[model samples]
Every structure is written in C-alpha cells, then in structure tokens.
Target: MGKDAPYVLVVGAGAVGTYFAARLWQAGARLAMLCRSDYEAVCKHGSFDIKSPHGDFKFIPEAIIKNPSECPVPPDFIIVSTKALPEIDVASLIRPAVHPKTSIVLLQNGIGFDEPLAAAFPGNELISGMTYIGVTRTAPGRIEHIDSGRVALGKFPRGISQNAQLLAGLFAKSSVPCEIHENILAKRWEKLVWNVPFNPISVLSRADTSAIMAHPASRELSRSLMEEVCSIAAVAGFPLQPGIVQKNLDYTAAMKPYKTSMLVDFENKRPMEIEAILGNPLRVAESHGLSVPNMRAIYALIQLLETGCRH
Candidate 1:
C-alpha cells in the first residue's frame, strides 16, 4: 500500500459506491471514482453527505475518472459496486486503475461473478464482499443510510491472502463492523437468501420491506422462497445457516420500513437487477434439477412487471 493515503477507485457512483467512498475518504483514503463527466456536478459542488447508520461522515474524492483513461496510474485498490448486469464491463473499466497488486472488491449483489471476474482480471487480487446496509441516493452526491450492517469479505478465490485481509481490515475500521468470512460464497448465497424473496416481490408488488413482510401470505411466501433458495445453495455446496427463514423474517421486521433497491428502480422505471439478482439463482437451481416454484413465481412476475413498465 502507498505510504500516503491509499489510492482507491470506485467503478460506479451509485448508492453503494458513494456511501463506502465517502466513509473511506473521510478516514484518510485518497479516492477516485470511475464515472461519466456528468457526475462532475458534484466536483463543482465540493462534496456530498450521508446519514450513516453509524455516525455520518463527508468527504470529496480527489478525482473522478470519466472512465479508465482518466486514471493515468493504477489505483492501490479498486472497488466495483455497480449493479450486477453492468458488471459485465468491469474488466474493461478497471484496466487503467488496476495493476498486479491492486485489490478489487466487488460489492454487487450476487454469487455468479466469482470465477468470471477473477478470469477477467487474472493476476490481480480479488475480494468478494457483502454489505447489508440499505442506502438511497437522495440526489447526486447525497445518500441516506437508513440502517447499517456489517461488511463481510474473504473466502474468495484466494481466501487467506494479505490483500483480502487488508481489504477486510480497512472496511472493519469503518463505522460498520467488518469480518473475514471463511466461506464468502456461502455468505453471498446467504445475502441472496433474503434478496430472492424480498427484492423482486417488493418491486413487483410496489411494497416496501414493512408492507411486504407485514402481510401474512406475502410473509409466508417469503419464507418458502428462502427455503427453496437454501435447498439449492446446499446442493451447490454453499450451506446456509439454520433458521435462515425465520431470521430473514425477523430481519425484515427489524429493518422494517426499508425500501429495497429493486423497489426504487421499479418506481423510477429504471432497469431492474432481476437478471443478476433473481435470474442467476433461478438458472443455477435449474441446472441442479432443484425445484424452486416460489422463486420462479416471483421471477416471472418481476419479468412481467418490467415489461409492463417498459411498455
């Protein structure tokens, strides 16, 4: 790592990227973001604010690359927090900001990218991470963190490496708790454990966390979806924690009144992450010849809803 502030680049200026960048920069990390020139609006305005689940902290990035070309030198670390579908272009975007030693942290919500991403940027260290915090962009350069959660990293292609540990350690130092997960894939699937049920159904039904979980039928449906997912995960060698169903229900209750990102996208008519978030798991389950009726139903509804929105 650089003796001076660590040079880090965030691929997307979306909610997750913005929240983490602000906190890391506040803690004395030199940050750069990969974004379009339009985002320069924040540059002129100075910085943005976050109502962190922990206390809020604010800072301005030293530079924001319109793309990789703007970064003349590779960053000490690169964190890509873009939505799943857009992740297809990460290798191309991070080229300028990546060296053999640059550690890449992916915050996208899905487990399918483990091998593909590592293959895309071979020789560079990779860390698979999951954060449960819910955040929304109130405006350009401004984010609201409704509730906070820990970030888990490690147990990736190279689990116990110093780079992975360093990545986990830096995030642990942040306001939210952080830990090294021995089985990051299981952790990733565990995140999907809730998302499979909550995200798509919420988006399609136009319900927030509270509305979705409060209703009996919908809540029961959520549990069935979770059980189906846990079954597939077990077959795929990623065993979920016991009581995942009840835990998710309890989580939704405690994290009540939260609006999932998919819900936000549906309301805004923006492209949803169904392909990477929902479709990926469904496909994986089918390949194993597993039954996932509940997920299939939710996935089908989200597809129909997205088509309706577009039309």
Candidate 2:
C-alpha cells in the first residue's frame, strides 16, 4: 500500500459495491473489482456507467477479475458489499484475496453478520460500515444512484482505526460524505430504525417506500416498528436521539419512489436478508428480556413469505 494510493479489492459488484468502487477509483485508489454477473459487460465496456446525484461518470477498474484468485496480489483493503444472506459463505468467498495486513471493510447491512468473518480471519482488521445511499444496479455494468450517498464506518468493538480513516478519506475525496462513528454497533442500530420499517414493509405490502409512508395505517406501523427498535437499542445501551423516528419518516418521505434491497431481492426471487436484518435483533431483544411485538410480527410475516419462496 503506497502513501498516496491504496490497493482496494471490491467484492460483490452490486449497487453498493459498484457505487463505492467507482467513487474510490475516482478518488485515485488502485482498484480491482470481482464481479459475477456483469464481468463480461464490465470487461467489454471497459468501465462501469454510474448515474449518480453527484454526477454521471464511468469508472474503469485497474483490474477486473471474476474470481478472487485472479487478483494480481493481496489488496490493502477488501471492501465487501455482498448481501448479508445466511447461506453465503463469506469467509470462503474472500479467502483467496486476503493477506495478513489486508483490512476487511464490510459495507454490509444487519447485526451479528461480522462475527463469523471476524472469527474466520482473526489476524485481519475488520471495519463495520453502513451506507445511507440510495443505489440500484439497473443493469449489467450500469448503476442508478438515486439519492443520498453518505457512509458511516467504525471498528468492530468501537473507535476509529487508521484503515477506517483511510477508507473514509477515500470516500470523502470522491465527494461522498463519510463519517467515522465511535460506536459502530450504535450506528447499525440507528440504521435499523430506517431499514426495519422500510425494507420489510415494502416487500410485504408490495409497495414503494412513498406509498407505505403515504398511508396513515402503514405510516403508523412504520413508526411503531421504529419505536420498538429504539427501545431495544436503548435497553442494549445505545440510546438513539429523540425524534429519530420522525427524522427517518421525513427522510423517507422526501426520497424518490424506491424499492428497498429486501424488496428488490423479493421481486427478483432472490432470498431476502431476513435473519441479518430482523432475526438477530429479535434474538438480542429477547435475551435482554425485552418484547418487540411489532418486530416479531413483521419477522413472522416475512418468514412466511420467505418460506413460500423456498418451497
């Protein structure tokens, strides 16, 4: 890793991965992206076409490999933007590209998903990340950056690290606002206030976020779910700010008509991240002797939907 440019390997060329990798490349980071579905498209086009709020641009990676083993060398940082699906073996997925000094930045969603990866590679640095951007992979090698594009990152337990700061700086250079939070877990919980309500409700109701929030009954349900998550987070010692529920509502209401990641997964017949997004939180709340009926009900409903898909 040079002082001016860090070698970054971006795994999962999905919406989040492509958005961040394009930004990093624009910021002058030497990047290698491992893409699956759009490998040939990216190779043929020689760049990724990104339609963003900041600006429209094309990003060509230093190396585009279909497999981790194809990378020239171990990267300074490996940014994983893969879905936090329970069945995915993330350790095996990124094993070939990991080196002793490689920092693993999980730009992923949900709680407790990092534990297995941390356990798999105890020698590497693990940075937990959460992105507030509205991005979607519209097609192969094409992305639509719908709304905000900011990120919050922190080390596993807490506090900021040099690697975390470096990644934040890279994002900042690319015009993406990146904040280093002292408590990453608290940040994850705060994100859940938005994700819990919008992600699942969108899928369950088969409606966009705007529609869900526009209706009074569904709007109240979203607020109730957010309050329940806040209560659980408070009991777990990461109390969120007052009016956070309204803040989330206002933010969602202002956003464009968009389907959440979970909703998109459902629409595409891909497995939704039920366990990571909802199951883990429910488990934690239960262990803390708290009852989250709203979350539990949503979880049950989503589980039924998932079970139907599986069958």
Candidate 3:
C-alpha cells in the first residue's frame, strides 16, 4: 500500500465487517481489525476465507488485534458492524482508536443507531451506512456471502461529506453498488421496511425467505408489517417511495432461500436485535399517535422470544 493509503480499523470483525473490510482492502485501504470470537482462529490462520458471489478471496489485514487498544495505528475510518443491541456501548468500544479526524462509520441496523456515537464523539464525523446484503459468518474465520452487497451512506443528521464520498468510492471500486444519499436516515427507514418484518418473522416461523414468501398467511402478514413501517416513516418525515411494500415483497419472493441474521442469531442461542429492528420503530409510531397494530404485535412477540432465548 502507498504511504497515503486510507487506514481503516474495523471494530467488529463479524461477517458484515469482514466482508466489507476485504472489499476495502481490495480498494487499497490499509486494514486493521479488532475482533472477538473469531480472534483465535483468525490469528492462527492469518486471514479470513471469504466465499462470495462476487468472487472468493483471502483477506489478510495489516493487523488483527483482540482489543481496540491494540490497534497499531490511528485509523482514518472506524467501521462498526456489530449487532445493534442495547447492551453494546459502541462509542466506548471504539473510543481508543478514534482520532480527532477519524470518520466513524456505522454499518449496523436500527433506527437512530448513530445518535449515541454522535453524542460520544461530537467532534468526529459520523458516517451513517445502511447495507442491503445477505452475508454471514458460518464458522470462525469463514464467511458465506449469499446475495446482494449494495450500501447507502451519508453523514449523520443529514447531508453528504468528503468522508462519506471517500468511503463510498472504496466500495464502488470493489464492485459493490454504493450510493451516497443526501438524507441517509430516509434510506435507513426504507430498509427497515424490509427488516422489521422479515427478520423477526423468520425467527418466529422458523422459516427462510423462500418459506415465508411461499405461504400466503405469512406473506400477507409481512405486507401488513411493511405498510405499518411506511406509515411510521411518513409520520416521522421520511416518506418512502410509492409501492415500496410490494417492491420489497417481490424482491424477497425472488431471493434465494436463506436465513435472516436474526434467525441465525436465535438458532445460535444468541441475543437477537429485537429492540433495534422492532422496538425503536414501534416507539416512533407511538410518539406520533399512529396505530400500527401489526407492528405492535410482532414487536411484543419477538421481545418475548428474545427473553426466552436469554434464559
């Protein structure tokens, strides 16, 4: 890499983080990773084995440290791709490597996921990223990419910036369709139109995308949930494009039979992102006095399911 190559520290080296990190590395960014569960296996192997539709590749970062404090150098970009559960204090987790000029990129899911980080690092630029992809870590140091890898990004609380463009350019070069939006929060909410229903329903029904779409009752339920999300988004001043609900349904119907991230977490006996995907949007509906019965019901059931998993 050149002396002026962008130094990036991926804070969560899970499936999403590892895949994107590998792509950025292909785009000529200097990479360092702060990993957790896969640390031992990755260290032993010296790289991650990425299986993808784009192409198979071995991703060897410049450094792989178990803690943020162990990061060898200050990074220009800090990518956080962990599950957006309430317990994770992402701001503090990456604080050790956040330089004054570093751009913090959040690649997780959730409404208002960037607020805490923004509050924690008031001086640093926060890039809000919404990824539309199906990738998972099937084993330690091994990732399986199923389908789709497009991403939309923007500066938090709105508008584009140089930092956003630089990051988007990297992904674009790596063959991932990357969009820089003037209002990324709208993009986030639009994604929630798909996530809010499918993720939890997958867990509750023990079904993949194919199974869910194949059954008429579950299919309609998914549609209702999506419409409720659209209503909430519009009330919150981020109205979606017309026919978005049907568009999402059609897309999912054509998608390969695959498990959702939440379903995978549930089957692994791990905490699902119930609060992030469901709780946050439901709160928005309540605050706006909008009635979203389907959303409310699903949220309650998923929270119950998550609680059961914990014990």
The best candidate in terms of TM-score: 3
Superposed model 3: Cα runs more than 4 Å off? none
Q: For model 1, how does the per-residue alpha-carbon lDDT over 1-311 read when each residue is reduced to its tens digit?
A: 34476778888877788888877776677788776533777766667677775777676777866776677456877888887774357787677667876888887787677677788887877888877776888877778887666677784653566766765556666765777877788888888888888888787688888998889998888889889889989998888889987988897888748778888888888888887777888889999999899888888888888888889
Candidate 2 lDDT tens digits, 134-241: 788888999999888889999987888999998899899888999998899899999999989999999999999999989999999999999999998999889999
The order of the candidates by TM-score, greatest first, is 3, 2, 1
**Relative to the unseen true structure, what is the C-alpha lDDT of residue 189 in candidate 2, on a scale of 0 to 100?**
90
Off by over 4 Å in 2: 1-4, 254-257
Evaluate all candidate structures by whole-model CA lDDT and list the values in order.
0.78, 0.90, 0.91
Per-candidate total of colliding backbone pairs: 0, 0, 0
What's model 1's lDDT at 275?
A: 79
| Candidate 3 residue-wise lDDT at 258 | 73
RMSD of 3: 1.5
